[model samples]
Structures are given as structure tokens and as C-alpha cells.
Target: MINMQMRNIGIMAHVDAGKTTVSERILFYTGKSRRIGDVDDGTTQMDWMEQEQQRGITIQSAATTCFWHDTHINLIDTPGHVDFTAEVERSLRVLDGAIAVFCAVGGVQPQSETVSRQANKYKVPRIAFINKMDRVGANYQSVLTQIAEKLHLNPLPIQLPIYENDNFAGVIDLITMQYLVFDESTQGATVIKESIPATYLTSAEEARTAMLDSLSTYSEEIINLLLEETPIPEELLISEIRKATVTRQIVPVMMGSALKNKGIQPLLDAITYFLPDPFELGSVAAKKIYKNKSEDIQVIRSESDDFIALIFKIQQDKESGALCYIRVYAGSIKAGTMVLNVGKDKKERIGKLYRMHARTPEQMNELKAGDVGVIQGFKLAQTGDTITNGAPILLESIQFPEPVISIAIEPKTIADMNKLKEVLTILQREDPTFIHKENTETGQLLISGMGELHLDVITTRARDEFKAQFNLGKPQVSYRESVESSSQATETFERPINGKETFAGLTLSVKASERGSGNKVINGLSNNVLPENYQAATIRGIEAALSSGITLGYPCLDVEVTIEDAVYNEDLAHEVAYQSLGAMLTEKIASNASPILLEPIMAVDIEVPNEYVGDVISKLTSRGGIVLGMDMNESIQIIHAQSPLTKMFGYSTELRSQSQGRASFSMKFSHYEKKLS
Candidate 1:
């Protein structure tokens, strides 16, 4: 078996920060590739997708494995764009650590801060890389200061750039007191390690002394050694730095230009030296049910424990059909094994196991704990489903944000309509956030997602991959309905023919709750007037009525309904009569319930040049946005605000035009709020 100490790390950064370029350097230096592929020319090995090449941006996360020294590293290169955040979130969930790349010239931009916040939330240990030192106006020290002040990171520089701008030559490794030069003699390739340059010796020593001072706080022994001016063992100091990083106390910042092929070796060394191994992360926490009836709670740890794996992503490949990507939490998973899907309470047999290599799959016989692999032919398995040995265990399901934007779609032809349902069903299964439901009142097939790009990609996938052609109506703003105040009303629908009589009556009161609480129904009828079964049927009818809004035909939320009174004849009453009466009574209540429109609200983060900050804020306010907060670093400002989704349909293009293509923003669903009168 491979060493359990292997760590899976992800390289994440803001767009145009050279994240993909950094990844390419890592691959090249590690001998994974004979020649480095540049992202500018659309020839990067990791960014292999057609859309990525055409758009000059990463659209999906790519995974690859390489060895640094003796430690095996599974690295994932994630897209920096906000549109592909789902990919980043899933990758973060499985990675042990992350390398956050920041452009030295730009410092920490909008997406960089946003992703940093996400990484902090996930409690993932990270190392910061200040890249692009070869670019003009690149100040490594200024960027480090920005990280400390803006990002609230206690950054200690482990490597310093030797020179800046066009004369950029090498980096001084503070830890080992070595100077590493980038050799362009071999086609702008190869990293050469050598002694520190005479001019940089004093600067390197000063930086190393400062690093030791920073480390002193983490250990009293280090402080004492520093105070006595005693020499500290290099290996011991490296071990302490790793411990501090794992504890999230210190972030070792390194500087180099990936474009120049400089500082790549030092960064790799820092990764293998500082990042914690999977075994160091301890066992994956999973709730397991005990065999004894008396005990209900148990926690499983490693492969020696009972087998358990959680499916984090699911995809419907064109040729391979359905594939479920899972992270093994405990024990070993093998082919032809029957695992119980604790979420669905169904047993599925794992037909084959494979390791994902980009879009290709390499067959594997078994996978141990802390490994990520794919299982085929498990039709019942889904993303977030927990698979375990028959022993029952309930794991928390993955939570996704509610979609704020929606589009109404329909088949253009009868042939397309015949296959639309199947295609849509598969799409919904792949992405939980992509909701598809038929509106009972309007009979429109509404599809909702995080934003316009998200829905567009899904529609494109449907047409290209599923071979289904359809017409999409103008993207409509998703509106909701809710009651303003409490109100009560009574209605009766009685049908009698030739002495055969069926009678049903109900009195209901509708009250509005806090925004986003959704609708709640209560049965207040006495047993003497109506049975419990009859009241349940009435609740179902009310649910059906509220699903499609009474006004613009959208769903309703944040309203409460109660059946205050009900009467039914035991001999003459039927279930159909109660259902019909409930429907009629609900419509009657809605007529006087004082329903109001609610629009979808989004949490937006905008990063723009200092000159355009005022313009961005003014435009947001003009569009009815509520500026929550503002953060400024260097020449860029990060504006956090909440705005109506309707106003943001084409804002990307507008923002690019207004800012002269120097600004970018990311927005996600926050919560639904009432529209102003």
C-alpha cells in the first residue's frame, strides 16, 4: 500500500493571477511533462477543455497526480471564475491543503479575497504564493503587506525575489539560505539552485531573522534560542513551521514568477515540507450505527474501520453513462461489493472502480480511506450520498444554495419534446441547484440556477450532449408571492343530485411570516367537524394551491395557512369533495390574504479599479442595490452588496464596458426579500 501520509492539495487563485501557469510549472519541474504548455497559447495540459481554450478561462476543475521527492501529491487546479465556484467548493471539500496564488502586481483582488474567505470558512490550511514578479510594478514586500493588512494573514516570507521587473533573476530561499535562479538557456526552462548572490546575502539574512522572530510566538524554545543567539537546527525549524501552518497560525508566503519559471522548486519544497499529510488530518469523521441495539452512535476512522465513502460529485458522461466520484472516508472500497446508500436506503453493487485522469478513467481494483475514485453502475448513488457496509449510518447531506435566476423552456419540435423529459431529469440529478419543475397554474417548465451563465451552460450541455433541441423563452425574473398580514375567510362548495349529497366547508386564516421562512399550514378543525384524514387532504390541497403564485404565477413563500373550521358528512362526504373544497377555500383566502411580490436577492462581490469604484457603487444603487460593505486594498476595491437578480442579467457585459474591462464580480443567491412598494 502507498504511504497514508499522501496529501491532496488544490491550487486556487483569482482570474488572470497565473494559477494555471503555476500549475504548469509544477508539472514541468516534477517531470510530469516534457515541455511546459502555456495557457496564453491555449496549450496547457490541465486546461484541456474546448470551452476553456476558446474563452481563455478555466471552466472546470482538473485533477492530476505527481510526486515531489518521495511524497505523492494529488493536485487539483480549480477555476478562479465565480461562475465555476461549485467546482472549487467540491474540490476544497476533498483537499487536505491549498496553495492560494495572488498576483504580485495586483495583490489580492476580488476573487482572491472571496476564495480566501471560503477557504477560511472550510478551515483549510493554506500557503500563499505571490506570483508574477517578472511583471512591471511588481512589489513583493508591498504585496506581502497587503496580505497581512487586507487578508488578516500573518504572512512570513519563506522566499524573497532577488530582482524585480525585466531584470528579475532569482529568489532567495530564507529557510535554506540558498539562491535559486531560473535558467532560460534551455528554452525558458529549468530551475538552478545555487548559493545566495553577494548583493542579496544581507537581505536574505534579515528576512530569515524576521521569520525566526515570527516563529518565536509559536514556541518558547525558539524564542529562547533566538534570544541567546544560538543556532537552531534547520530540520527542527522546518518542522516547527509545518506545525504552525497546520495549526493555521502562520502562512508562509513565497514569491516568484511562474511565467519566468522562477521560484517553482522552492514552492514545491515548501509544499512537501509544510503541508500536512492525509494521515496527519486524522480519520475522516463519519457517524456509524453500532450492531448492538443499545448503542446508537459510533464514529469510524480509517481503512481498518468499517468501509464508508461519501459521493461528492456526479456526472453523466456521454460514453460512460453515469459516474459517481466519491471520497473514501473509512475502510477499503472494492469492485463487485454491495454497499448500502444510507441516504436512500437502497443497496447498490459497485461494478467497477476507476481513478479519474482528466476525462479518462483508469481502472483500479480497490481504493483505501482518504482516496478519491469513481464507482460505475451505481444508478441509485447520487452526489452527497454516503455509501457504507450494510451497517447503517446517517451522514449529513451536501447543502447547495437556492437558485436565484430562472428561465422558462420548451421543446421546439415533437421529437425534441419526446426526449426533453429524460434529458432534464438527468441534468437535475447531476446538479441539485438546477431545479426543474412544471408550474401547475402556468404550465411552464421553469429551470433555475445561480446565474445566467450557469443556466446557459446547462442548456448548451443538453443540446450538445443529449442531442435535444429546444426553444428557451426570454429569461424571466423569478418572483414570489406572500401574504402581508393575517386574514380569515370561509367558503362552502356543496354538490347534491337526486338525494345523493356531498358537502364540505372550511374556514382558513392566512398570515405572513418572516421573509424566506416559506409557507406553513396548520389543521385547526375539531374532530367532531372533520376527521384527521380529511384535514390532511385539505393540507395537501392548500400546498398544491400555494405552489404556483396567485399573481404572476410564481411560487409563494413566508405565509402560514390554518383551517380554522371544517364540516363533512360521514355518509355523503368523499375525498374528492374535501380536495375540491380545500382548493376553492384556498383561492377564496388568497383573494383577501393581501399577497405581495418578492424578488430574488443576490449577494454580490465586485472587484474593480480604484477609479471605477465610485461608478460601480453608483450603478449598483441605481439598480436598487444595498451596499453591505466595502473593502479597499491597493488600487482595487471590493464592494459587497445585495441586489435584485433581475437587474443583474447582463450586468457582466455592462460592468466590463463601464470599467474598460478592468473590473470583475461574483454573485450568488443570498435570500428572497419583499419588493418595495
Candidate 2:
């Protein structure tokens, strides 16, 4: 039986680094499946989505359970594509540890570095896997060296590959001083426990010594013992390894060719022995609500003593209605129990508990601490909502990156309008990064995401899952406008009727602000000229005017506006008329200040063969890109640059053709920069 103390982990990697193959091998060896699923055939159990099968790439993170050496292991396989980075981000939020995969031939790819940075951001302890050691040009030693030099990680190899290319057979475990050989005909792993392989003894000993030397840094006593040439206790060494892993001081790198089933058992053993459990981290961070004497609520941290759970993901099931996935931090949650949603300030009753298996779910009665499970009929629970058993807890919400690409979408026929609305609403709820907004001025429904693939997946989901037909326009870059310099303007609106005149006047000033500071309105009118309520109405009007820009009808940001003076007639003063007049004055001032268009710029990191670096750089520059820096290691070159989103509409196809399928790039929204004349 597997140990109950075991916690869940996630495996993340860049595209085409054999992450799914590794997952498949683990499932096969653990007896969860009778046969392994191959990514080449699009039959991987974790990537069951139709879009994933069609594209042969994982679009959503997949979760599964298995056993390794009497320890229960819950593994979540995350997407490597930059467009679906939200999947990796959400998975890391709940995972206790991770296996970051890097290809032996490619070493650390661009997306690999991206995911590594994300794991570090979440403080997730990780182990490295150098997969595909049997492929041509595969060099395990070079990849391990790259992990230390390029990614800035202290990677100690626990197992050494015995052969390369077609001769690859097994691996030698440094800790156990044993050799594990794979019998392909029997599809089973055999351990040669009696003696070490003579061919690998020298390299294995060197690797073992290196492992011991690295472990010694975690403890002075171990270093002293090593210096004195005394034998260190195995238990003490294991304890130090566990401690170093939990503290994220070192990452253990292992090599394997999952396709050949070589080195699989050793990798599983390392995971069970080296990875840290959730309880080892003491308590997950959360926030609780405290009621003050004034009947107001305040947020407080709840580490372990409080009952806290955060809703990380939510799905709409066709048969079950809605399923909310939650991660419990401190306490157990039972089915049919009432819990408070501190974020929404509402109460919800859990209908049923389910242990997730990718798209399928297994029914359960309860979920304990440090467990991830799904609850049905949580109407008030959102992606970032907090659930509490005792007092209400208001935890920090998850923040997603902004969308960089956008397209205007409309229903093909009037009959499909209602369906489109329904589909878009559901898609927005499911994907936090997708933004669907109705542009009232332009009469367009704009959908935005990280890139073209991101938006394409949503449209595919709408058609396949929701049965909705829609028309999409060419992708467009989402942009904004702001004032270039400070200026002031005064305007008056007067109406004369029956020889009597009603008048309103206002003076406003516009000033530039720091980038991303957004728009702000300050009211400086005296009470004698305009009442407080009228001043408030004027401020609202100014905000409305600024939102629908004075140029190109885009949103304005990084600017400040102040209403310096105002004149109003008490008899003729009306909220609607005063607000309308203020709106006109704000627009007048904005036009006089000379606004400039600010286009979205993306931070792009590309990894390609050294021979193709020149072509990639030339193509990027042709698209108005500015090269920030270049890094070269071994046979690949990594280029970092900034490019306008408007110039990158079809760059993906160009990049693929330029590198002949030997390159990959990941880009995210960096900032907005003014368009040069």
C-alpha cells in the first residue's frame, strides 16, 4: 500500500521535450495502465482534449495518480506552450514539488527557462529530468552542464546513463551503488544488486562523489566527515538531501529515454526519495477574516491552525452542472457542508466531492488537508475564491497576465447571437487571461489572449464544445493613447431662451504620468460655484471621456486631469446637463494637449540553432524589433528582443519556416511604448 503522507506534484517542460512520454512511462511502470500511451499517436491519457489530440500538444493541465515504492503520487502534467502558461501557473499554485523536464539534445530551451522562472516565483522545489538520451546528438553530460551554467542551477546527477544512442540500455544509481537494466522483451526492469557494471564503475564513482560533495554543503558535519575521510551515515545523508530539497538549495538531475523504457525505475525512485511532501513545508499560506468591534471585517493570515481553502480552478460539467476544484490548506472539507466564500461574501453548500482524473472524476465523500479535489454546485465559488469552515477567510486572489493579441468576433447569423454570448461568457469564466468586452462605440465584441494560439483554442472550444458558429476578423494589436505633455483649456456651454441665459463653464488641465499609472481625476472646484455632488458628477464624466480616448477611440492611460474652475446656475443646474457639459470640456482639454498612440510591445525570447540565429534576428528586425541581447551556448543561440504586437501577426509561421522546425519562441506583454513618427 502507498503511504498516506504523500502529496501531489507536477511535471512541467518546454514543447517537444518528451514531458508526456515521461508521464506515460510513469503510469505504465506503476501499473495504472496495461499499456503506455504514445504522444506520437495522440493517445496520451493526460492530453485527452480534442484540440490537444488534433494539434498533438497539451492545451490544459492533466492530473493523475500513481504509486512509486509504496508512496502515493499525484502528478499534474502542465502545458509547455507560452500561450497556455496559465495552465502551468495554476498547477504550480497547488503542487508541492515539480519535475522540470529538459531535452538532452536541446538542453534548456526558451520555454524551459520560462517555466523554471515561474516555479521559482511560486517557491516550488523541483527536480530536473534530462530526457531523450537515446536520440541522435543526445549528450547527457552536456545537458547537465548546461543546467548549471545556462539556467544557474546546482544540478547533481543521481543516476548516470550507461550508453548513448542505440546502445542506451540502463542507468547506474549513485546513492544505492547498483545498476538497473531494462529488459525490453519482458517490459520489466531488473536490478543487478550484486555488483556494479565494470564499464560504468569509474564514472559512477565520480558522480557519487560529486553528489556527496554537493550534499555536504547543507551540513557542516557532513563536510567535516568528508574531510576526515570517514564514512557518513546513510540516514544522515538522506536527511540532508531531503532538507536541501525542501529548502530548494539544490535540484537533482536524472537522465532517461522514456521511449526505450531505460532509466525509468531509477527516475521514479529518485522522485519518491528526494521530493518533499506538503507537510514538510509546515503550512500553506492563506488569509482569514477577523470581525472588528465596529462590525467591520479585516483579513489575517492563516497558516495551519485555521480552516482555509482556495478555489484554484472551476469547470462546467455537462452532466454534473459545475465542478469547482479546490486546494485545502489547513483542514478537511466534507460533502454537503456549508462554507463561506469570503471573496464573494456568500455561503455555498458543497454537493459532492470528487478526486480529479483529467476529464474524468472519481466520487469521494470528503477531502482532507493538503488534498486537491472538486466540489459540485458551488455557485458562488470563482477561480480565486476562498472557502472557510469556521470564520470567513479572504485570501489573496490569483492575478493573470494581460492578453497581448485580440480579434473582433461576431455571430455569423442573428440566430447564433444568443449562443455566442453564452459561449463567450463561459469561456471567459474558464480562462482568466481571456478578455471578452463589447465595444459599444465600435459595435464590436473583442476577444483577447496571450497569442494567436490562445485565441484559436477558445474558438475551437466554442465550436466543438458549445456548438456555436462565429465570424472572426483579422487579429489586431490592443493599443492605448495618452497625452504627450501638460496643457489647460477652458470652455463654456450657454443656452439662451426667452431673453434669459443659462450657463456652465469649466477649466481643466491634463498632465502626463508615469507609464501604466492610468488615468486620475482631481476635483478642485469651490462649494460656492459647484456643490460636492456636482463635483462628483463632473469627475465621473471626466473618467468616461478619458476611457473612450480622444484619438483612435482607444482607452487612455498614464495621464492626470484636474477640474480647476467651474460655474453653475442653481436654478438651471441638473446632474445630467452638468455631467454632459463636463464631458465636453474634458474632451476639449484632451484634444488641445495632443494625444499620442501607445502600441503594445512584447518581450520575446527565442531559442534556435546557431546557424538559424541570423535568420531569426533578421526577420525580427524586419518586423520593427529591437534586439536587447544575445546568448550562445553549445549549438544553440538565445535571442531576447522587444517587438510591437502589430508587427508580429503571422511571425509564428515565418519563424517555423525560417528555422525549418528547429526553433521555438515565447513572448509576453512587456509594456506600452509610444509610436515613433
Candidate 3:
């Protein structure tokens, strides 16, 4: 059961790797648009947001639909910056395949590795598009090598770039053994296929032989033909390559200057030929919950099956309210259908369905299986929520990285306080990585996000889009608290309830767990020690105390708490008394345990020239950075290092001054480490 007529793919790359440009070219060549959109000119359809257009960087993943010949392509253009990594993550969760675009000049950048790892995590097979072949110092071979070395992906080059006097001319299609030259006069709308030139013929043959040799492992027929010295048919080669790609055995590599539109059409053909269709994916594993019991279930990928869709993205529209972007994995869903949101445990009536084209939407009556569309008027639907008609099936929710940075925000005026709160709620619904919480002790509203840029974008939107007036404080590191050693505490809590006195006694022990294991509660007490009704109440109170942390008021992490014993009076002890006793015991252990403050450490990658390497390293080390490793790619020196997020703040500006604007760096949250006194 395979439908070859549909392809759901995403374009991902490092910042400035030209993924958006590739998307723009796809739109123009697919006849979806008559004019090509330019990123520099701020005319690109995929980057439709005003902030994105002004910054010339994609902040959010944008989805659009277009056609390549008879095949319908549902394409998502994802952001490459580290701040927007969650967008790439959620998109990959639902995508059937992806296109990993790499910069020819800046090969294997930090964000490229991040996105590649994300794609790998979701088991989304992807093809490599060596983009920006026309840039100065562009080397597709170097990029290909880096892709294999850094990403650890089996990259089989299917197209060989042809250069004429150090200028990118065209590409030689290895499968067809033909030259592809896009007509510049027609804005690369006309693809001219010619014979491989004499000078490039040998290289093309070598690449083709290498491709066949790699692909032969997937098909015995191809291996037999290669062994017998029989001419392999294009059909056989393509079929074997597609098979390998679908199984993620090998990534078919293509080279192109996406901006110049030299090799886009062939790339489109590769996407349709290699990427898996929904039917090919078969059923997805999910959990069915009924009567407080859960069982594993498979949601079939067919229109006849029960309806199920994953809400991957949520957008707030001024006139229409919330727009929920969904990937329909099971049966069809129509407007006005009553659906159950499994995560929220609420029922919502589907509003209007939309076939979204960036900011524009075309009304649709139904969203069928294997298709991506938007549903409006969902009051309960949020990102990572699974919606179903009645199956009670819960699909795996998308996991987002924790926010590493925070900023204090306050309404500009007392009248704007409610407006700010309302806007924050809307923003949180749209971005899973964005967190806003009220600090009970300080009474300040704190908004946290993945990075500085992430918070900046959110604050801008709150002020401009939602028209909320808010003042922001300086960025701060979102730290956590953890214990270094085990400790035990016992406490008796007594409170007056109604007209009766209630009493309870609890004993608990706290120990450090493995870093990133997070907080876990273990009930060591036998059922006879504590009644089942009060056990849950005690655990909830202990969890709440752990969330408030020890002394610093930061959330606790990597801590294991065990309830050792509980004593309660039959008539005097109630749920409230037990809950209070649990919290008191946890707080008592916090006083005895050797608690430490944990700061977010970042994995930083800096690319600079050899001459500026010493200066950059000196500056980084002065900020308490540790040099992990370094490598030389072409003439650029890439330094891999780790540093505390607290010290690394505003380091980018300093690095620019030190390297005279030649060095560039990217960092992501690596781990939480103990902070020095």
C-alpha cells in the first residue's frame, strides 16, 4: 500500500545555508508561483513573517503545498538557528522525509548537526542538498566529506557539480549520465538536459560507479549486474536507490546552487522518487487508555481507520483565533466533526479546515489521511496534542528542549497587566519551548526561552502583534538545584480541620540521581503503612516541594525521593494532614542535604580564520570556557568548546570584536553543571 503521488518533506539546514532559498525555488519551479522570491529582498513566501523578513532568518517553521508534475508535495521550511530548534524538532516528528541542506562554503555548521541529529532521532530519512555551490570557496566534495564525517551519514552523491573556470556551471546527473543546465532567461523555469561534457565525463562516470557500488548492497539484482559487467538500467538503479533511501540505508546526495536555480528541478524529482509516502509508513504505534488502564495499539494509516492527527503547531490569528496545524495519520477528519483531544482530555468541535500556504489559507472541507492541514477554533488543542474521533488512542507527544534563558517582564502600565498575561498565554500555546511563570516569592513575571533571540522574538511579538505593553529585564540563566548527598528527615504535621484536630507523621529520604534523570518519587512504605487514598496526596505534596527547590527556589533536578514510613491517627489524620506532613518532611531533608546550584552549560562551536584562533580562544577561556577540540576545514578553524551559559551571555559581541567580525559561533544547551562558589 504505497501512494507515490504524495511527498511530505521538510527543508532543513544551518543558518544562512539557503534552505529558505531552496524552498522559494521549489515554489517557482513547481508553477506554484510565477515569480521567484528572494530572501535578501524580503519577498520570500516561506519567510512570511515581518521579523523573519527583516532579519533575513527564519524563526518559525512554515508549511506550504505545491506540485511537482503529478506528485503533490507538502513541504515545510524549518528554521536553522539554534533558538528555533524546537520548530525543526516538532516538524520532524510528523514529516515523512526531509532534505538536509548543507552550505558548500560553511560545511557542517553547528545547527546543521543539530537538525541532522533531530532528523535521526525521529528516523526521518533525508537527502543531502549541497547548496550554495556558487558561493566563493564553495566545495561540494568538502561538504560531502564533512557530511559523512560529522553527521555519520552514508552520503551517496547522485549528481556531480561541473565548474567552468572556478564558476559553478551546471550539474551532471549521475543516474542519467546527462548534463543539467537551467535556463537563466526563464528564471530557471526551463531545464535543459545535455550530454556530459568530455572533460567532466570521467568524473561523472566515477561518481556513478560509486553510487551504484553503494546502492548495490540494497538490491541483489544490481549487484549481479555489476558483477556480470552488464549495463545496469536507469530504472533498476533508481529503484534500488529509492529502496535504500526509504530505509535510511544511504542518503542520496545532490549538488546545486539553489539561489541560482541550477539544480532544483532534479532535486524535486529526487524527493518524489525517494521519500516515503504515508501508505509506505504503514501503522504508527500509540497507546490506548481506557478505564485507567493503558494498552499499546497501532493506528493504521488508512482512510477507513479511526481518525487521528497530531497537532504539531499552533498559530494565533487575529480574525480567526487559533489555527492548529495537524498531520493526519489515520482516517479523514472534516470540519464540524467532534474530536477528542487525548492529552487535554477535552472534546472540541472542529472548525474550518485550511490548506495553508504560509500566511494564506485555502478553505477545505476535509483533511484526509497522509495530508497536512490546519484546523481553526480549537480551544483545547495545543502543540504535541493528539486528536481523535473516538478511539482514545494517544500518539507519542513531541519533546521540546528546556528553555535555558529567562527574562523578567512587567507590564508597562497597570492597565496593561491583564493584556500582558493574556498575550503570554497565547504565546505559550504557540511555542512549547517558551515558558512563562510567576515567581511567587518576588512577584515578578519571568518568561524563559531557549536563547536570547527566542525571548527577543517573543517580546517583540507581544508588543507588536498582540499589542501588549511590557517592559523586559536583562536576560538571566535558568538554573536548577540538586543535592550532592543523601539525607533523611522526619516530621509530624498537625492542622485543625473543621472543628477537629488532624495529625500525621512522615519520614522521607533524598538522594542524588544521575544527572538529567530528573525528579523521581519512590514509595518504600507498604500499603499497610499508608492508605492508598492518602499515598497519592503525600506524593503530590512532595513533588510540589521539589518543584519549588531547596534554598534558591529553583526547580530541583536529578533527585530521588523515597517515602520511608508514615503514621496516621485513624480519626484525626486526613488527606490534608498527610499532604502537609509530606511537604514538611521534604523541606526538612533539604536543610540536611548538601544542595548545590546548577548552571546550564552550552556546547559552543566557533568558526574563525587561523590568525584569529588564538585571540578567540583566549577570550573564551577567560570567560571560564573549556576547549574541547578543534579542527581545520579549508582555511577556517572550527573550535569546539563548552562554557557556562551565565558567562557566555553577550560573548557573541565580544567575539566579533576580537576576530574583527571574521569569527562566528553557535551554542546549544549541553548539560547542567555545579556552579562554583
Candidate 4:
């Protein structure tokens, strides 16, 4: 049976695109909260952390549950900033549906494209919302075009913005051919519907016709009705639209200003009507592993199947240890059930289960399939781990990008050393992209992340949340090394340990691959040349060499290594001999391949006033920036450019001073390129 009453959805967008604001409205209108919370006031229910409230940005993903029109919606509000993109990534992996919010003034921003690609990768059906319609220079038509051109999405606009006396008053519902307005007296709780006004009838009819024309492919009856010049039924239009949306053929577009509280109710109605329920998504793919072998399998999305869940997130709780947030895919389990951690290969008992509403939790005796809740008292559960009833099934795990920037950090006082160390451990467990290590040469502690803002957020949390004082050195770019050409090397190892002779011989070749392809190891030797039992040891050694780069001691990328020939002595030579030969030959070949340094390039979008455009461009170009393009929205100028991450460390402050605080920008990792002098 399909569980059509439950929906799993998330709100995702670029920073300052009003994602949290829209979430606040959803909570207030659903009666989960008494009043709407504001981001500027540090009162949003989703951004519960102190750093989030102070910075007015969401630093982590927050999950909650609410009811809309008798439908239970499990909602996740993901972070919009690029630094916390891992939060958005993992959230998208587990979500069946999402709301991709876009700002009306700044259409198709950088991070906006990032989140859209993430949602696309997961095959999550989505509905687009053109938010900030109340802001100046808000162009609904322009944004619609950008969505089609830049995002490569077929945007089906279901509503058209209505302007009365030069103000964003309401919207026209194309499906019902009615004018929908919100009552400010009730904080937009009461929606007022009326016949289309006389002035907007022509435009409304045209839009409704286009909507039906696109949706006609799903239903023959509507195509027949349109051919006969007959009015289409509202039920038929809705049915066809829902079909297209659930299949991800088209993204139903809606317009609203989340801050002004206009057009939110219709968006909520759209969520319930168009978004897919858990049952509609069908079965999930997983791997069944047993006896050192694995096979593909499908886990049915039903409550009667064996218990299975994926822990998508882990949060440390001061009072109750770690909180493992899971989304159940099959069967039902009660509190205190002993579950097997498929990834960890261990068994742990569930101490408590609770349905979370922001920071608060409501205890539950049992959690059923198609539900998202927190499980406590599991010592072995981790992010991306599968928990099952000893089924030996493993689901696909979430992947995060490597950190591209680093900074040296240490506690300000020796008294706070232990506390700071504890904080770092917890943070690393919570976030996969955050990496911390000690420099073997300089003996300095280093922390690396996606960008400078990422490290800033971490240090701020250490001081404010954990009450640990710390200082940071200047930001450093995390460069990578790759070969410029192919090279080959052969090495022979002979050693005597404890009167035992160890001997091994191997030939290795190294070559550069496509940029951003990462490192790969391949075996070209035949079974006669190298036995199957020794391949694992040789490959492991080669991987170890890849991590220890030949040039500058940085990591290696976009490189391929192949083992061509090998000789082993079964009686005298051990695995360590082959491992030593493999590592030695791999490094020698890479060093001979003519290695070069690679740097991270950022795709930057800057919105500045017209007068300061030239100055901004000049400053950016002086820092090795390349101007990609520019767009104009009224008096505001949008500049698109690419610059190295090293030159952008303090660009935000300089831009503010140059533009006199009239310009704002958003940036994200674009790609890695050969470092310029």
C-alpha cells in the first residue's frame, strides 16, 4: 500500500535567498509555531545555533515535522552558504522532494546552481519558488528565462505576479483562473480569492493557455478540450500537472515574497498537491553483502519488510551523547531494539527515539517506515552508515568534496587545550569535509575546509559555543599536484630482516588524467606475472604513495597509476616486500612525470551599483580575476567572474569599502586549474 499521507521534503537555495524565511512561514501557517520568526531578529526556529543567530545565516541543517491539510510533512531546512554545502548535499541524498528557492532580483546565482545540480544528481523531484518579489527590480519574467537558460530546467509557471498601484499586491492562479490575495490582519493565515481583475484577464488567459498546452501531453482529455475551444476542468489540470512534477519532467513555478507573507498558502498547497509521497518514489537500491561477496538488491518501501534505515546526520548532545538522525526505508522498530550497523559491523541498542521539532523533541515508543526521527544511545552509528536487522544490506553513502583551504590554529591558553581538542573531535565527526591534522615538519596544528568562511565559522563556534579561546594564522590555499606527462619506473627490493630474505620486483607507470577526475590505480599485469593474492597489497601501497605527493608535499589529483609487471617470491617474500616496492616505484615514476601545482578557482557573482562597477572590476582584475560577464537590473549591476581562492581571502571587506556597502557577492568552488605565477 502507498503511504500517500506522508511527504519528505527540503528547502534549498543560495545564501540570503530567503530559505529560512520561507521555512518560518511554513511553520507559522501550519500552526506549529504561534508567530512567524525573523532571521534578522535571531528568532527563526530552524537556525537554533548561537553562531547562526549572530551571523543571520543557517550554519547547519535543521529538521522538523508539521501538518498541512491533514498531510504530515517531514521538512528539512538546509544551509544556503557555500561553506556548509555538505549539509545541503547529505540532505538532498535522503530527500524524496525539495523546494528550490530563488531570489527574484538575483536570478540563477552561483550557489543556486550548485544546489540545483545536487538535487538533480539525487533525482529529487522539485518545485521552484521565485522569492523576494517585494524587493526592488524584481523581474519575474527575467528570472523565468534564467531558470530555463542557466539551470536547464523547464519552468512551468503556475502563478503570475499581479501589481496594483506599483506594489506587489497578489498573484493570479492560472489553474483556477482566480485572483488570490493574502490578508495581513491574520498574518496571511486567511487567503482571499476573487475573479480575475479586468486589467489582468488577457495576460492571465494567455498564461493559463500555455500551462494547459504544456500539461496536455499528460492527459488526452485536456488536449481534446483545448482543441474544441472548451474550458478545461480544474481537477484535470491539477492531475496532469502533478503527474509531470512527480516524474520530474517539469518544475512547477510559483512566486511569493516570504518576508511580506504573500502567496505562501498557495505554495503550501502546492507542496501537498504536487510533491511525491514516500510510497510514490518506489523501491530503493542497495547492495547485499555476505561471505566477502556483494550483489545488487532492491529494498521495498514498505512497513512489513525487514527493518532498514540510513543515518544521514550525527549531532553531539551535551546531556545525551550523540543523536543519530535516520530516515527509515523499511519495516518498523521500537525503542530499545538491538540494531546492526551495516557499515561498522557492530550491534547497538537504541536508547531513545524522538520526533524532532527544531530543538525540541517529542518521545515516541515506535518509529515506522517513511518517518524521520532521531535515535539515541548508539555508540557505533555514524553519518552515511546503514542500520538494519542483520540483513547485510548496504545503501549508497553521501560523498563530500575535499577541503580547498587551510589555516593554522591553536588554543589561546594552555588551560583550554583539552576542551578545544574535544570540540575539534566532535566537529570532525559531524562534518565530513572538515579536516584537522598536525604538521609533521612545523609541528603546527592545521585545519582545512572548503573556504575561508568555513574556517571562520568553526573558530567562532569554538569560542562562543564551547567557550574555548583560540587564535588562527593567515589563511592558506590547499594546493594540489598533478603530472604534466606520462612516465614509467621500475624498482627491485631486496632486504634481510631477522635472518629472512625478502625480495620483490614491480614496474609502475604514471600519467595525468582529466582535471577534477581524482586519482585512480589500475592493474595491467597478468595473473602469470603477479598473483591475485598480492594485488591488494600492491594497490594499497600505490594509494599510500598518491597521498604523499612528489612535489611540495601536497596531495595529488587527476593522476592514474598502473602496475605493468611484478615478480614475487612466494616462499621467501612477504606482503611487506611487494608493498615497499610498489610505494617506491610509484613515487619515482610520479617525480619523473613533470608535476605542476593546481589552485582552486571560484565562480563569483557580484551585485554592485552602476557607478562602482568599473572600480570593482579593476580591483578584481588586479587580483588575477577574469570577468566572465555582467547583467543589469535597474540601477544594480551583476558581475560574473572567476578568481583564485588565494586572492579572495579579504575581498569581501575591500569590496565593501570600494562600493561603500552598496554591493554584495556570492562565490563557490568552480574548478581547479594550473597555478599562475
For every candidate in turn, the CA RMSD to the true structure comes to: 4.7, 4.7, 1.7, 2.0
Cα lDDT, model 4, residue 422: 82
Q: Lowest lDDT 10-mer window, candidate 3? A: 1-10
State in Å the error of residue 492, model 3: 3.0
Indicate whether candidate 2 or candidate 3 has the larger lDDT.
3
lDDT of 1 at 122: 66
For model 4, what is the C-alpha lDDT against the true structure?
0.89
Q: Mark the regions of model 3 whose C-alpha exceeds 4 Å error after superposition.
A: 1-4, 498-501, 568-573
Q: What are the runs in model 1 whose C-alpha is more than 4 Å off?
A: 1-4, 164-166, 186-189, 283-285, 289-298, 487-594, 605-621, 625-642, 659-662
lDDT of 2 by residue, 63-155 (tens): 877877677788899998989998888888878899988888878877887788888888888889889988777888888877888778788
Q: Name the top lDDT candidate.
A: 3
- Residue 372 lDDT in model 3? 94
Residue 29 displacement (Å), model 4: 0.9
Collision count of model 2: 0
Give the poorly placed runs of model 2, Cα more than 4 Å off. Answer: 1-3, 164-166, 188-194, 290-306, 487-511, 516-550, 557-594, 607-613, 633-636, 659-663
Candidate 4 collision pairs = none
- In model 4, where is the ten-residue run with the lowest total lDDT? 1-10
Worst 10 residues of 2 by lDDT: 293-302
Which residue pairs in candidate 1 have backbone atoms (N, alpha carbon, C) closer than 3 angstroms, thus clashing? Answer: 303-331, 518-558
TM-score of candidate 3 relative to the true fold:
0.97
Error of 2 at 548 (Å): 5.0
Taking all chains together, each candidate's TM-score versus the true structure is: 0.85, 0.87, 0.97, 0.96
Q: Rate the local accuracy (lDDT) of all candidates.
A: 0.81, 0.81, 0.91, 0.89
What's model 1's lDDT at 444? 72
